[model samples]
Target: MRREFAILAILGSLLLAGCSQLERLTLIRPSAQHRGYTQIAPRYDFSGKHGRDTGDAAMLLAAGSMFFQRGQLDEAEEQARKALKAQPGSGDANTLLGLIADARGDAAGAGLLFRSVADAAPANGVYANNYGAWLCANGRAAESLDWFDRAMADPAYPTPVRALANAGDCARKAGQPVRAEASWRAALALDATHPQALAGMAAMAFAQGEYLEARAFVERWLAVAPDEPAALQLAMQVEEKRGDNVAASRYRSRLQAISPGPTTAPRTQ
Candidate 1:
């Protein structure tokens, strides 16, 4: 789950630096999966839902993590605080709290909380991945790679593919197309159905002017994540490029159906 948010914000910094290469490339907006957090947040604990204590540190940590993943910062912070009250220096609680700070745009505070966990436990893959994501969001992609590596080094990481996909996304942001391709391929080798990897591969193909191939790749991605507006946009663009006006029009109509409004924003890479 933590792997969903790798640290590597190099490309974003490049944008700040006014890198000209990005002008020719499609910029990829981060997907929910790439943001790497999606868990449910329950506001109240029902009486005797289970034998678990409502305020138990572990329970609080889990609920907090879920809330943080779902982007419910207030609930997550509340749970994390309760967990901390029960057991200070909790890695889980600290991670959730840090994530909440990040969502709220408190980079300094989030960095501090993430550091508390990463510094305390170097071998913790989850913390490493999450910290790396934090570093990237703050425009430190170069420094985030090692943290991603550290996360994958641990066999206990629940989802190594997430780290791999995140690393690929970071590579693209850093303007290393070759590295990005390799990372995406690696992710595919691990899990052929990985949505981000497929979508990334599609983006790579589109960048290279291989419209048909890009279509195929993104079609696979759409199968995995049917609701992603970006994928539909890609499909429309790819069909237009391939001279299939009928299909292109169909995709355009679909896009309009899903997201009603002006369709004027330039598509991202």
Candidate 2:
């Protein structure tokens, strides 16, 4: 059961592509809640050669982004590859390819691609943040912390929340509990109910054997996203720790019913 819980956590982190502080905050409010935030109609600018030429590299890149947004991983990858062939070393192309690789479960490939971009453009905060996130997810917590630092140092980085959250996660993985707690607290100050911050807190509590605290964290998470698979699995863990075998079994069955195939395991405590 512990192994299963760990695997589920890892899988949950992987499935959430943009695993940064800002991205986690974005998930706090479902799309329905966005209605209360701000709404804007889609806009397109089409007044260039790239617009006229369907096979143009820029156009292909745009198309790839659209496909990626639509969850067409194969199409997005193919288009991104075509763009890269036309313009080798293009940052946008490389980033798109890396995202496609990540979507297809190739974390190493994605990391390599993003690293290449970071090597080429050391000042690019986007590359730094993305690579740092990949490193953290792949278990290189110490190395990821450096990249997160670089991202934070860049004034042009639009999302400071993401960099801080990622750094905090790396700190937590590196066993710096106090620093991790501080980082998460900072993230919560920016956006209360941030998913990753809440989830990370729960994970930390579980690691420390504070099952009730962990349960409370996950419960709050579920209050916002009741059907979140990770939350459901964590709830099961809490139930098991509380000696509620029947409840735990029910959660396990629900998880199996939702994702029964041979899927990747969750994160470890």
Candidate 3:
């Protein structure tokens, strides 16, 4: 359950290719309510051999991205590798490869690839967010905070709220409740119905034995993410704390319906 609360749930954003004719494209499969991402589309000018190669790589990368979204990992990797071959050091190709590695459970490999891309493109907030999410999900929660900050600092980053919510999750994991709350508050200010922020507030409240506050946050979270297993589990725990057996049972039934296996909530007071 704690793992599900990670900011990595917010996956890859789009990768830009070429310098001309920009349009938005989705590079990763969408998840939950808030994870769809976009980036400038590729329109390479075939003015020279190098330009033609870049255009080919961009086409391969775009095809690879579509394959990835469709869950064809092998095909995706093959296309990404071809893209890399066409455009050596292509950040977009590396991003797709990194995502594929992650989906295949190669966290260390994925981290290295993502880090290389983030380092190569210091001003790219999307890459920064990707690296931060990987770090937090892989147990370096404290170190991940700086990357999220970097993501937010990029004025062109379309979704600062994503970084803020992720920062809140990492802050809490790093045992910085004050920072976590502050980050979550900032995220909620931007998007009032942000599920992760609401979940963080609820967990913090529950841990502090503020059952009423926890319940309020849980209600808000559930209203937005009705089918989320974590939210349902947390709601059950909060209801139990409030001695509302009926409500607890209702939440438990919903959770079990979605996920039969037991899921332990974060430690509470």
Candidate 4:
């Protein structure tokens, strides 16, 4: 059993500058697109011979997902539990329930639930990726890398780049910079403008005293995510390293404007 886990910090936290964005676990029901809810990528089609009530369970899962997206956690949990009752071994229902548990700060329960589904369907890259992210967030960074790799092993996985980017984050956290860089490069190869990959590369270059390369990556990152505080923070660092105090201060001013409260100067690398 794991210890009680800490809740993830909001995006605006100062520590965000040090790590890539963690993809939020979302329910991706196939029917969601037709129902006017925004459809997310990595479409996980949950198919299995659960029971005679499979259609009922699917509808319930879709409803639960809509509720979850709307911030109605209680309603979402109720629907997810009902779906589970209809189809006892439904991976979709279990995944939804895990997401609800995650929202409620029950990380241990969430991890168990996620792991159950991932183990049940080894080929389901979406489930593997979600579980990997959960592991990374719960202080199991080293173990998470294998799950991310498993996700990428599936050719049908729609968002291999997402798993790659996440793998880089967990690898870096696990003190494996070489593995992290490889993962980041793989993600960038798939999607050159990926913000997380760009951010990771920029941070790596800055750390290695490659200010010019870091600046270029920062420019690319900011182009895609102009308001991303971390990119702005890194931009400031790059300019300062290159002896361009004026550019650094400009980025500092921009960052301070968007960030809450009085901002402290970011540390020198």
Single out the weakest 10-residue window by summed lDDT for candidate 2.
Answer: 1-10
Model 2 ranges with Cα > 4 A deviation: 1-58, 69-78, 81-89, 102-109, 239-268
Across 1-269, the per-residue lDDT of candidate 2 in tens digits comes to 00000001112444344433213311110011111211221233323333323555666666666566567888777777776677676666787787677677777787798799778878766567777877777778778878878876877655567667777777887888888888777877787776777787887887788999988888877776666788778878888888998988877777788888633333534
**CA lDDT scores, all candidates in order:** 0.66, 0.64, 0.70, 0.71
| Cα RMSD for predicted model 3 | 9.5
Candidate 1 lDDT at 3 equals: 36
Model 2 whole-model lDDT (C-alpha atoms): 0.64
Query: Which candidate do you rate higher for TM-score, 1 or 4?
Result: 4
Candidate 1 C-alpha lDDT tens digits along 1-269: 23322222223212212323222111111111323333322344523263134556656665555555455668767777887787677666676676566557677897898778887878767777767766665677667778888878977665667667767777787787887788789889999988778878898899899888899998998898776778888888888889999998887887899899755432545
Candidate 3 accuracy as TM-score:
0.77
What is residue 188's positional error in candidate 3, in angstroms?
0.7
| Candidates arranged by lDDT, highest first | 4, 3, 1, 2
lDDT score, candidate 1:
0.66
Model 4 Cα displacement at 201 (Å)? 1.0
User: Which ranges in model 1 have alpha carbons more than 4 Å from their true place?
Assistant: 1-55, 63-72
